[model samples]
Target: MHQKRPHVLGIDDGPFRKQQDGEVPIVGVVMEGATLVEGVALTSFPVDGAEATAFLADWVRGLRWMASLHAIVLGGITIAGLGVVDLRRLAGELDRPVLAVTRRETDGSDLAAALHAAGLSERMAVVERTPPAWRLERGLYVRAAGVEAAEAERLLRATLHKARLPEPLRVAHLIGAALVNGQSRGRV
Candidate 1:
């Protein structure tokens, strides 16, 4: 009973300025089972903006190898500070299950305040629509779109290697970090 390992495309964003509009590098690492297969990079607006979802969707749609992917994994639910990703829209655009992974539980009040301050209060509805983050093994948490929590748990367990973060996301994080800073270090 040998089951084929699923291929996953993991995405992550690089560090950016908090106060101004700037370009942040977004990296996507494709993994077949535990093996790294491909990597792609794109840019998105700074924190508390509305460009991550469309940029990600367009990048995924343009990738010829995307058809082979079983799912999409994100390092976090937001990029460039408070620029929240619309996971549901991304999943619908790609027709693939999407999972956003985080190392800690998020504070809703704090997020709301930030959105309000940024004049992005309307974006709160999108965040509200996102599935709650579920704790998986080894202290990792995840919110999924177009995929069941149980299935996401199974995939996380299957793909994790060397750290709490999955390999694809880990690689993407490292690449993004290196691109922003000269080196990649600390928890992403």
Candidate 2:
């Protein structure tokens, strides 16, 4: 079969919470490939003042944009100190295979249950939990599939190491975070 640009979407979901409402979720979508497609930041409904169910509906609505995506690598915070963002709701929005990464400290079964509870259990892959220390320089993990294993590995490694952040998604982080921070500060 022929292939398109061979891209993967890496997501880093975050939330900002107040004393009363708890956590507010913000999603960052990063597209990694030759052209480095732009990343988008979206608020999943309740984050923007809508009801939770309605927000989930709106969040899932963005999947059409990723119809061409080959795979998705998903990760969210789980540290008790950091306060976790439930990613299963967002995962339900995706229609492709998903690799969910967590902290090495997290139990695999717990992670699976989390996704399953969110109704995304079928499309999930549990990756070895990587720590925040390692994530400082690595924004996303790139993978190449549907090709020679060696070739795929080579391409992924090259892209991941090419820079501290891949072109497409890094800008997404900047823009998305800026928007979130701006909104928080009442600047935007």
Candidate 3:
């Protein structure tokens, strides 16, 4: 019998802040499963703080599902965004492979430095100097072993378009942001 491939988890963080009093801080995380564009699954976590760092830190601390992941993909914004998150640090905490993607021309030296500082450079993959507008929503594709790098790469490239966020992360972003947005408004 053929075995199913493991799902690659796509991880990303975003922040939420209120302009007025009595509002709660919000951070959004989107974790997507590897599959076809329609097969991706999304889960989100929201926390306090306007800084992306806060969200990342919280997400790392609260990450209870890493043991089942094959690999992790992190957004450039999440790595470079402000707050308390250290991409390298978080990668060190996990036993899985970590890849960081960005459209910028730089080497993502900062991210690499941080990961190296945390002793996780070996597990980190940086796809830098990519063409413009590569994609808006950042995420990972969870896949099973022996799935061929070309196949995985093809799937990732096909779905991550300029407009539509990857399904898993897109749904998670919406869920997390809406959750906080509703709370800030005191809505049901």
Number of the top-ranking candidate, with TM-score as the measure: 1
Q: Give the higher-TM-score candidate: 2 or 3.
A: 2
Question: Which has the better TM-score: candidate 1, or candidate 2?
Answer: 1
Task: Please give, for residues 27-146, the per-residue lDDT of candidate 2 as tens digits.
Answer: 546565645664565653232232332343355456555656655444433321122333433344544433333334333466566555656454333223322212222444322222
Q: Give residue 23's lDDT in candidate 3 (0 to 100).
A: 33
For 11-127, candidate 3 gives per-residue lDDT tens digits of: 544344423233333222333333433223333333322344344445544656544555445544343222223344444555443444443434446756655565555423322
Off by over 4 Å in 1: 1-3
Give the TM-score of each candidate.
0.90, 0.45, 0.42
After superposition on all CA atoms, how large is the RMSD of candidate 3?
9.5
**Full candidate order by TM-score, most accurate first:** 1, 2, 3
Candidate 3 Cα outliers beyond 4 Å, as residue runs: 1-5, 14-64, 77-81, 101-164, 183-188
Cα displacement (angstroms), candidate 1, residue 169, comes to 0.7
